[model samples]
Target: MTSHTWRLQPEGTAHDDRYDARADCHRRLRGPYTGLGTLLRSLVPDAHRARPELVAHHAVEILSAAPELKDLIGAGPQTLTSLAVPNERTRLYPAKRTRRLAHGIIEFLHGHARERGHALALRFDRVDEADHTDQEFLAILLRRALPDLVMVTVHTGGTDLIPELTTTLAAHATHTIAQHPDEHEDLTDNHKLALAYVESDGTSHDPAEQAAYRRVDAAERARLHDQRAAELRRSGDWSLCLGAIPYHLEHGSDREAAADAFLEAAEYLVSMGFYHSLLDVAGRGTALMDPAEEPRKYWMLGTKVTTALAILGRPEEAERRYIELRAMFDQPMLHIFSGYALAMLYTRYYPAEQKDHQLAKAHLNNVLAMASLLPDHDQRVFQSVFNRNGLALVELQLGNPTEALRLVSTGLADIDRELPAEKHRLHRSVLVHNRGRVYTALGRLEEALADIDTVIELDPNYPDYYFDRADVRRRMGDLPGALADYSESITFAAPFWEMHYNRADLRLELGDLAGAIADLGYVLELEPDELDARINLASLLREQDDAAGSLAQIEEGLRHHPGDARLLCARGLLALDAGADQAALRDFDLALNAEPDLVSALANRAALVLETGDHRTAVADLTRALAIEADNPDLLYNRGYVHQSAGDWESASRDYTAALLLPGADRADLLRHRAECHLALGDPTAHQADLAAAESAASSPNAAADPVRS
Candidate 1:
């Protein structure tokens, strides 16, 4: 098999400021996955052939995040509505979404390659100017996809790509080419030049074209924008609204139309979880209008931007913008909306040290007060219940589970009493879900399970509700039920590594070691840098006597997380198991230096030192390990053995006595050791009592071998 190359060149140039070049390409191509889908369709012309459902599943997954593609994908109204519903229970972060997309694409490619013995090559130009969503998708695809299945050549405008994309190119690209620009064409016709620029969605980097386009009068340029926007609107491809339509209208003659387009796009992007894009488009819309004159439109855009800021981890900026907007707009609805947003910012998005539940509660109260002032009684009731759900979350975060439960109950009651069952279905589901969470926190597992079950019935398509129900079932000791729920969750969504990770633990608990291993391996495939999954997988592989697999996992984890203490300690234990004592000692020392209080490293190192007859060092290591695990009988027993070996009878006697007092202690051995120590310390009465206890324990059926000796 010949190895294919993927090239990326990110070039920086002037006159590329109008729009994101790569995003424009994406819009023109319909979506990020369209090329792959087209290739698959070409490979198998019959729509029934080659698992088209897989392709459609992934297409739906991408559409869920970028719903503007509904027109291009021919998604039905019901399908679009289902995909558009915001999943409040689980926040699928951008990176995870990228990983899921990459996984789905690779799966599709592999299936195609299996049936049709052929490889595909794809190229993308101006990748540096791609939007965050496209860049992240390309970066993950480059890193994870097999080279033989698909070769990607990315011609970045410059080397100014995002850090992740740049790193992926540097590490994965097979060849790098630097090409100098040729002489620019003499474009004397201003009309032709401006047309070319607009037709390309402002992706023209030609200096001559740029200069000619700039020479065109503003009236003509606005006329061109208006024409382009009308053309895109007539094309019936909604995805263009995310890019070309909005870009054209923003530069069009009508400022109000531009603001309206941007506001619509902002709301669409926000729902799609494209917060960075939402922030940009919303800011542009805000710039085109005055807050004082267009307060409602301005507040709508401003609130979306504020939400984007908070979701993007800029809480301070979000807070500042919220305050600025609130001061500018005195409307009750503005206060209600912005107030709820600010409350969520404090309750969820703020840094841990900066989070203030009391402050969040105050904001929620303000939202409720504003809601009451609304003229419409139904609006007041709906807003009150909606904001009260947030207040419940704040109370939960404040460690007031009872109060949170009460708040959730009141919200549910109001929704049921005041609103029709069909009204506010989404919010009703949210309240039920929040109530479930509160019940779980309050240790009311049955109630939590009931609430989760109800929410799952209400919104059966959402995966997080199943995951949440699984958790409650797990806590309720319904292992089989929890396992089924977890499987159902995985089935409902694309690929949630977290659900797999949790299910792996559940499988392990149920003694399905193979299932646990498979789930953990899948988790690593979805997220390679998942250190906890790596560690658990390594340990599980070792349990199954696959030492090589375990070592590979540890090495791979170390490659990502060098000097990680848990990994190092695990490596040390593996080395010791293989009789590489010096290597084990070195790794243990390194692990300890990285984390001094690492109990496992300390205890294992104590064992190694004891083997070398370093009794004092062994005793010191065990003593420190004991500090971290005060009630550990094994550590106490080991320390007693080391002290006894060092001829420290008093210390040995104290340690042995402590070990005997612990639950599940090796009673016969501990008693015998304590009797010997007591005799050595000349405590005749204590020695006699311990000797009698030792004899009695040895005869007991429940007695086991000494852990220290074993």
Candidate 2:
């Protein structure tokens, strides 16, 4: 053990020389190993390494342009669309995907640390030399990509080295875009060099950086890209600018219709370098055009025109342009946009009659069409916006409040996302109101109350939201809440005719008949054609037995919204109360003609028809009413009365039996009717049993409170 060391003395001199040179090479090459250190140094030069990928990476972030941008920039004197870049492609999935991709790259770097930061640098050329450790390269990439908060500053040039030249360029462009959130948002290919200043101590800077960022020679840059940039350049000239100014007297740029024409003129003026015309357009409107979009691709010009008209309450003009643009190219997105526009137009004015119904249906159909067209990755986006609103409208139109409530609540539950967030928070607020309406109709007080609360939290300014909520609160027997919401709604915007009418109805509910009458008076003054308000006011007057006053109100309302179905229905109800059966029947028939599917009209008409001895016609009307709301206690009782009056005791007994299974029905009365049927059929035992069961069920107040509602 003590003599284990072996001597390496060579026996021959010549043999020793060969071994010396070989060992010297080995000593030089091995950093620690010996030999060939100089040989390795000759091939691998580390100090001048370049990292272009870092620059490109930053370029990608800073230059994302809108898909429609090229057209705007190259509009060739058509005027630029100045809305600027479309927002970034955002989705919740990105959050999930980023963490996983980062984790994998990070783990890979841990295994090969020598090439850590260098590995992420994008390489455009072939490499024939030995490389750094994979772990090192991977670490380098992970460092470049780790989000700002977590990623430390990367020193690519060792302790003293600034980031590569390309990285500096990328950082500049990125920093500029970051500083100016309003402009430089679109990260398109052309804006690549603009991101060089994202991070700096203001020490090491690139000579090419200023050259790239300067827009002083925009004309030259345009020429650099050949005719496309030239086209963008040509559109910014003065000749086209002159035509942009409005020369008309009278209806000047201040008018909404003229405003649209003024914007179109601006496009011409800006393109032709007509600064004077640009000034005129600016005088007419507040929003400015972008110089970048010199030849401006006419902006969402169609969208703007339609929106302006809709705002001005000119649905005819809005619809014309909406249709014109919609037909230019047939895509499902157009349907969503058009339908939304139409729905807004109708909703804003509070359309009545068949037009409101038609618009509502069209709106829903458009949403469905949009859903059908969405890409797989994007399908959930529209769902997040429209699911509750469109479905609730369809449900209300179909008169299935329970089904509507169930579906809409479910839709709200599924809107799960995070971070940058969904852009339609305002629209979602509207959906909350829509759901509240459904719940109100279904008489789900507590659930409806919760939804209305959320709607207020989302948007207090939306006109219809408050009215819908007030209606819900009134149904919940909260008179104070209902009154407050109604008052708040009208206070915010007096042009909302419906809120005035709603407040009036709430006043009547609170039994302040005078107050209700006064509110209705105000509503009618603003909207003389509001038949519902007039009818309600008339009914309230009639309730106070001021028949003359009621009759006068009805006549005046009818004069304005002449022969409205709701008015006829109200007048008929009044006549029936006045014991004018013949007159009541005539009025009900007229009401049905105006709105055939009106449940109140059908039920009232059927009762009149039955009393008039037309049992066959009475039964048909009752049957259809039952189809609409089979669970309506009044409708069911009326149908039973029809059958009994028609001399069909057996059929009459069945109708009464069905009525007993629904809400608000007098179980004792049903038993008596059924017993009468049994007596007529000589069934004493059946009659006795019916009498006992009805009395027992009605004896319990708790039992009576719940309905057999089937």
Give the per-residue lDDT digits (tens) of candidate 1, residues 103-215: 66566555565555644445655565666666676787787767666556666545656788777777877554565654555767778977888876776776777777788
Residue 88 displacement in candidate 2 (angstroms): 16
**Local accuracy of candidate 2 as per-residue lDDT tens digits, 551-587:** 8888888866776887888788788888998788888
Top model number, TM-score = 1
Query: TM-score, each model?
Result: 0.90, 0.44
C-alpha lDDT of residue 507 in model 1:
98
